[model samples]
Target chain A: QKEVEQDPGPLSVPEGAIVSLNCTYSNSAFQYFMWYRQYSRKGPELLMYTYSSGNKEDGRFTAQVDKSSKYISLFIRDSQPSDSATYLCAMIRDNYGQNFVFGPGTRLSVLP
Target chain B: DARVTQTPRHKVTEMGQEVTMRCQPILGHNTVFWYRQTMMQGLELLAYFRNRAPLDDSGMPKDRFSAEMPDATLATLKIQPSEPRDSAVYFCASGLTRQGRNEKLFFGSGTQLSVL
Candidate 1:
């Protein structure tokens, strides 16, 4: 099984709606969780980051990590057309140096 | 804004040719990473370096793929005898430290490679 799993969603939402993107993983060793946003032809950009099992908020984006369930989520409030992009979840162990594992991103489109 | 820089924004090479992609990490960032993105495989970590020293590269195919950080400023990923399946966008990202899990990664636009 892949270390991380996410729905390859082409989810569409209306402007001003709330958007939630999620991922699940089988590796309990993953302690660092992150969310990245990538527009077409662009590289993944860091959106939100969290450590262990907790929530971190940044502007309109909220990242939640549940270590017990090995699940992570990113919530966007009052979404805008500019927020339309692919959201990717990534995880790594907390050790000094470790490689990251990324999930298949969820594509989101916010329409007017 | 300090950003990672990658060369040859787009590359189209014939199969079995040697392909080399380069990256210049953000100044002062000690960690550099190479990733491959494809429609079916999503994003795969091919290799990473810490302080110009390789920490992990198991994700890469040892026979054909190689990664190196010859100096603090440059990192490279080379694929020889490239196959058609090697066609994908290659990304380079740099981080400040290996200690902070929350440390933000600065990414380059990416190198779109097509092996025909």
Candidate 2:
């Protein structure tokens, strides 16, 4: 099994809807989780970051990590068309110098 | 705002040719990363450096791919004898610290490479 597993969803939602993207990992060693947004033909931008378990909120976005279940999620509130992009979940065991494992990414489209 | 900068946003080269991409990390960032994105592979970490010292490159193919940090600000990734399969978007990201930690990454626009 892949170290990280995320549904490569082309999930479509109406604007202003709440969107939840999730990822599950097989490696319990992973201690840090991150969410990135990638627009078409552009680089991935860091959206939310969390360590271990619990939740971190930034304005309209929230990131949750469940170390026990090896699962993580990013919740978007009041989604906009500008939020339409690929959401990638990445995890690492330690510092930035170490290897990072990334999920396949879920493609989201927030339609107006 | 500080941001990672990449040059030659797009590159097209023939198979077997050498392709080099460059990046300038945000000032004072201690860590840099190289990643490749392909339709089938999604995103893969090719290599990374901490404080100008390479820490890991196991994800890269040693035969044709090489990554380096010549200085604190500059990082480069080279692919020699490139193949059509090597075509992908290469991204450079810089962070304040090393991996399993909480360091926000600032990424460049990326270099879209096409090996014909």
The docking quality of candidate 1, as DockQ, is 0.60
lDDT of 2 by residue, B12-56 (tens): 999999999999999999889999999899888899988888888
- Name every residue pair that clashes in candidate 2: A94-B99, A94-B100, A94-B101, A95-B98, A95-B99, A95-B100, A96-B98, A96-B99, A97-B98, A97-B99
lDDT of 1 by residue, A1-112 (tens): 8889999989999999999999999988888788999999999998887786788889999999888888999999999999999999988777667777789999999998
Per-residue C-alpha lDDT of model 2 across residues A79-106, encoded as one tens digit per residue: 9999999999998776334666789999
Residue B33 displacement (Å), model 2: 0.9
Shift of residue A18 alpha carbon in model 2, Å: 1.1
TM-score of chain B of each: 0.95, 0.95
Model 2 alpha-carbon drift over 4 Å, by segment: B98-102
Candidate 1, residues B52-84, lDDT tens digits: the string is 989889889999999999999999999998999
Indicate the TM-score of model 2: 0.95
Residue B15, candidate 1: Cα error in Å is 1.3
List, for all models, the DockQ compared with the true complex.
0.60, 0.62
